[model samples]
Target chain A: MHVMIIGAVGMLGKKLASVIAKTRQCNGQSVTRLTLVDIAVAETPENPAFPIESLAFDLSHTDTAPLLTKRRPDIIFHLAAIVSGEAENDFEKGYAINLDGTRHLFEAIRRERDRNGNAADYRPRVVFTSSIAVFGGPYPDTISDTFFRTPQTSYGTQKAIGELLLEDYTRRGFMDGVGLRLPTICIRPGLPNKAASGFFSSILREPLVGQPATLPVEDTVRHWHASPRAAVRFLLHAGTMDSSRLGHRRTLNMPGLSATVAEQVEALRTVAGNDAIALIRREPNPDIAAIIAAWPQDFTADRATDLGFRAERSFEDIIAVHIEDELGATSA
Target chain B: MHVMIIGAVGMLGKKLASVIAKTRQCNGQSVTRLTLVDIAVAETPENPAFPIESLAFDLSHTDTAPLLTKRRPDIIFHLAAIVSGEAENDFEKGYAINLDGTRHLFEAIRRERDRNGNAADYRPRVVFTSSIAVFGGPYPDTISDTFFRTPQTSYGTQKAIGELLLEDYTRRGFMDGVGLRLPTICIRPGLPNKAASGFFSSILREPLVGQPATLPVEDTVRHWHASPRAAVRFLLHAGTMDSSRLGHRRTLNMPGLSATVAEQVEALRTVAGNDAIALIRREPNPDIAAIIAAWPQDFTADRATDLGFRAERSFEDIIAVHIEDELGATSA
Candidate 1:
């Protein structure tokens, strides 16, 4: 079996690649070939069980999709996207990369299937990483899987469009697709980027590492979260799960721990004591607060739960997962 | 004020143009110029109070959208699309016209806004005609505004994508847009097309005109509907309604009458007597029956109703409107 990971240079992409490299398989089949692609040249993981090929790929260009599909990887993990803040700031760039690029990639697969006489048997498993941002405010307390997607940001709109295309493509038998609407990754293992939700991770991640962090929103501001480990697990599970279980809808809201800012702080206190809690400074930024206000706070991801997907049970577990995975420590 | 109507050569477009021409206004504002565009040369409506121009415009071509937007019509009624059956048969053609074409038109508007220094105040009122096909089966008895859109057909997917784009563009302040998810237009004036839902109109229309019509499904098959006249009214209202009322969501489930085939037949009998009803024949085509079975049966269009948009109250009223408008009489 062969597998391809788009956006392989990003933090999650890199982590996913390392995991797949170590296992040498996905869902049980031996992965003999691994293709890692991103905007910048991706590094081939050292001494994987199978052959690894790294390539620079940009989906915004029309010709890039065809080149990427030429290998006809058995499974494709599409994680590439413009971050939310940037997507909102630059409308054209966001749609060009997020919307058009995804559409072109789907079309490329369709064309490839038709080009060969084996269109009847050409179907690849597509695991797409969507976000909870697909739901806007004026929402219910616990958003159900069947709730409408009224994205307030351009990035969310792009993802929503991608979800629609994915379902239609899957229905037409061009691909076997499953989209996981991921929650914000708690303790993202990287330096802060331009996303407004960066503070969610920074407040916890920075303090745990003995650094100062700012809290932009109130202690009561709640949001959904999962660790990097859980996100990777979701992708692998989606790739192998029975598409028949999903029926006509190709996407499901991923299960995650919904915690308020105070709960996260309390969890931090339980792990690292008063010293770590002191590192969190309340530097209120109204702009960031306003953006967070419109975001989804909680969800009843019943569909995904029933489908065998799991997540951390508590904020403490989430923090511990971050420490164990990122800091290489079993306990704080 | 100036107005532009895409797909102006079709039935609804022709009726809309004639209405606007007769009134010389839309939303209480005088229409000084009218631009009618379609894949074929649109026939110019004669003796209008305003100046009218007809042109052959195919949106599938990249250059056509920009050219159409050059005039910067204050109101744009975007109703162009390939019907369901054709889109299902030809995948590439559907995406080209429905997806890419819509995107290019929105882009053209954005570019025009930025071209001059008046970007802040150049937002046009875009009234887009979406369809109830955006909602697939596994639906509640009465689908609400908050139900998720899980389109089962290629046409539905295209329209769903269009709705997402329209909302994003409006949110970005590129344009003031309102998308109306119109139910199937009943008692359609023209000849039957390739649409699977064509029978919904044909069964009612043909018998009213003293011609035989076939029913492809059981009498219990329920579906949502509104008259073509009501559809035109909805578009006109959307063109003028205050965008402030819509909040962040740009689309609404349009108000429509929910009736079963039995109810439709009963209404037909009331309008044209048992003699006309005898013209109807039961010829079950399993292919069409399976297609219609997956469609939405009813909707609670509360949002549209609260916003002051109205439709025919009953199936009898719908039949009456068709008779008065098309047959030039209150009854056959």
Candidate 2:
């Protein structure tokens, strides 16, 4: 099996690559080769059991997609995207990269299938990373699987569009596609990216490591989240799952823990003590608060749960995963 | 008020144009000019109260959108699309005209807004015609406002994507937009188009006019529908309505009558007598039946209803509408 990971330089991408490298397989198939692609060349995973190739390509450029699909990887994990805050701030750049970039890749795959002559011979499993951002507010207490997507941000709109394209292309037999609407990754490792939800992670991650982090929204503000480990699991499951089970709706609202900022702080106290909670500096930013307000606070995620996807039961479990994985802790 | 219709040559587009020509105003504002655009030059409406220009253009061409938006009409009615059957048959043409074409028009509007210097100076009302095709089957008894869009066809996917763009662009303040998810127009006049739903109209239309029409699906098949007159009213309402009422979710499920094929035949019998009903031929084309099966059968368009949009109360009313509007009947 040849596995390709787009946006492989990003935090989740790197971790996913490391996991794949250690496993030496995907969906029970032996990994013959692995390809890591991003805007910059991704670093090689240590002691990989398979041949690994790294490529730097900007998918927004129309030509880049064809090059990426030239080798026809058996499974393609598309995690590349302009983060929410950046996309909201720069409309054209957001559409170019997030929307056009995704479409170009899908089109490339379709063209490759056409070139193969036997259409059935080249259909790859395309695992697309979507986000809860596809949903907007005035949401029910628990957003159901059937909740409509009325995205308030350009980034969300682009992602929603990508989901539509993914399902359509998959239905047309261009590819076997699965879209995972990943919840915001709690305690995301590394420095914050431009995503509006970055603070959700930064507040917890920075404090646990004895560093001060700004809390942009009030403690009462609630949001959905899952650990990096859970997100990676969701990706693998989507990549390997039987497409027939998905029916016509290829996207799933991933199961996640819903926690308010106050609850998150309490979880930090439970896991890392009072000093860690004290590191959280409350500095309200209305802009961030407004954006967060328009986001979904919780979801039923019944469909995903029924499909065998799972998430942390509590915020402490999420923080524990971050500690074990990123802080080099053997046990939480 | 300056009005522009993108698909001015289409059945609904022509009717909308004729109505505008007769009204001499839109949204209580005096009509100044009307621009009609299509792949072919549209015929001018008879005895116009304002100057009207018909232009032949394809929106899929990148340059065409800019030209259409050069004058910046006060209200833009984008009714252009590749119908469902045609879009499904030709993949490239579907995405080219339905998806890219809509994007180009939107981009053009945004650029035109930018060129105006003050972002507030040239914002126009963009009325986009979406379809019930955005919702697929395995549906609720009556689809609610918050039901997710899982389009089963390429044309539907394109419209759902367009709706997302409309909301995002509108939210960004580039243009004031409203998207109406029009139900199938029943008892349609003239020759049937390539839409998979064409038979829904033809079965009623042809028989009423003393022509034999094929019924490809069983009498048990249920579907949602509205009349051409009601569709025009929805467009006019969308074009003139105070958009602030829409909040962030701009697209709406327009009110429609839900009826079975048997019910439609009964309505036809009542309206045009038993002789007209006998003109219907039941051939049971499985291909068309499969496509129709995936379509939405009913909707509780409470949002659109509360906002003052109305459709026929019964299938009889729908038949009455067709007879009065198309058959030159003084009374039903």
Candidate 3:
């Protein structure tokens, strides 16, 4: 099977690539070839078991989608997006990459499928990474599987639009698509970024490394999260799962661990003791607090759970996964 | 107030234009000018009204939106779209006219609003007509305000996307917008068309006019509906209502009456007597039945009701509305 991964340089994309390379298969089929595409060419996964082609291409360019789609990979993992903060800060660029780029890919796939007037042969499984941000606040305590999406931010809006397009395209038989509304990846393996929600990860990731980290909101503030491993697992599951099981709603709210800031801290303390907990400085910024306040704290995620998607049961398990995966250790 | 109607040649658009002309005002502001736009120029309404400009323009064109927005009408009623059947049959044309066309208009408005970045002026009230088609079944008995949009058709998908864009643009302060999810308009005045739902209107309309009409589905099949006059009222209400009152969710499930086809026939019998009902023919088409079966049956419509948008309380009242509006009579 030929598998294509867009946004192959991003953290999750990179991890997913390495895992696929190690496994040498996708959806129970041998990976004959792997295509990695991004704005910058990704480094080839070390000692890959399949022929790997890394391509540097901007999806926002009108020609990029068609060029990439012509190869007709058996499975396409579309993980590219402008992060929420950047999208909000730069509207045009955000829409260009997040909206137009995604649309172009879908349209390109349709065109390729119908290249010959009578030929409707090419149909690939498109696994798109949507986000929990597609929802906004004035949310129920635990958002149900069927809650309406009223995104407060432009990034969220773009993702919501992408979900709609994915469903429509899939329904029209242009592609077999699955949209995973992924929760924020906690214990993200890197230095803290400027995203309002970055603290959710940094506070844990930094402390695990014996470094000081900042906490921007009250301990009572709750948010949804999943480990990077679980997110990648979701992509794999979506890629392999029967499209008929998805029914008419192509998007699924991925199962996640919902915890308050204090719960996250407690989990860290359980894993790394008081020294790591003490490293978290309580310097609350009200602007970030207000932004986080409007975010969804929890979701039922019943549909995904029923469809055999799973997440870490507890925050401690989440921290453990991070340590095992990122630190290459069993314990923090 | 300068009012512009993008689909001024359509049935509801023409009625809205005539009503506005007769009132000589909108939102308590005197009507100074009226701009009617469509694929073909609309005929001018009768005298004693504001200066009227009817323009022939296709919104799908890249330049048309910018040209239309240059004038900056105070209230822009965007009621343009490709019908569901056409959209289903011609996928590319559907996306081109419905999706791209809507995006261009919104983008044009944004550009027009930000022409002078420092000025932060030119925010117009954009009232968009969405539809109940945004919902598909496997539905609840009564779809609530918060039900997720899982559009089964391309046209519905396009409208759902438009709603998302409307909310985002409004939230960003690019424009003040309102999206009304209009129910099926019943007792339509014109001759029966090829639409699957056409019988919902023709059953009553044709019989009332002493002509035979076909009923394609079972009498037990329920559906939501509003009068054309009520649809126009919803538009005007959306255009003039305080933006702040809409809060974060700019789109509304417009108030409508939910009734079974049997109830419609009973209402027709009550109003026009058995002589009119005798003209009804039962055809029982499986194709049309399957199509109607998947449509939304009812809605709570609490939000729109609370917002002061009103609709006919009964199917009889709906028929009365048609009689008064089209037949030039107080009663059937």
TM-score for each candidate, following the candidate numbering? 0.98, 0.96, 0.98
| Proportion of true contacts reproduced by candidate 2 | 1.00
Per-residue lDDT value at A234 in model 2:
89
Residues A1-332, candidate 2, lDDT per residue (tens digit)?
89999999998898888888888877566778999999999999666667999999999999999998989999999999998888988999999999999999999999998786767778999999999889888888989988888788898999999999999999999999999999888888888665668889998888877899889889999889999999998888887888799998999999999999999999889998999888988989999898788788999999899998999999889988988999889545
Candidate 1 lDDT tens digits, B1-332 = 99999989888898898889888888688889999999998888667677899889789898888898888899999999988887889988998888888888998998888887777867899988898888887888889898888899899999999999999899888999999999889988878765778888988889988999888899999989999999999999998888799988889999999999999999998888999899989998899899888889888999999998899888899999988999889864
Better of 2 and 3 by lDDT: 3
- Per prediction, fnat is 0.97, 1.00, 0.97
- Between which residue pairs do clashes occur in model 1? none
For model 2 the local lDDT of residue B227 reads 95
- In candidate 3 chain A, where is summed lDDT lowest over 10 consecutive residues? A22-31
RMSD of each: 1.4, 2.0, 1.3
Compared with the real two-chain complex, what DockQ does model 3 have?
Answer: 0.91
What is candidate 3's TM-score against the reference?
Answer: 0.98
Model 3: residue A33 alpha-carbon error in angstroms: 0.7
Give me the candidate number with maximum lDDT.
3
Give the per-residue lDDT of model 1 (tens digit) for A1-332.
88999989887888888888989877666788999989999888666677899989789999999898888988999999997888888887898889888888888888778777788866889898888878887989999999998898899999999999999999999999999999999989888665788998998999999999989889999999999999988888887889899998999999999999999999999998899999999989999998888888999999999999999899899889988999989984
Candidate 1 vs 2: which has more DockQ? 1
By DockQ, the better pick of 2 and 3 is: 3
lDDT on C-alpha atoms for all candidate structures: 0.89, 0.90, 0.92
Model 3, A1-332: lDDT tens digits are: 88999999999889888888888877466788999999999999676777999999999999999998899998999999999989999999999999999999999999999886745789999999999889987889999988988899999999999999999999989899999999999879988988898999999999888999999899999999999999988888888888799888999999999999999999999999999999999999999999999899999999999998999899999999998999989974
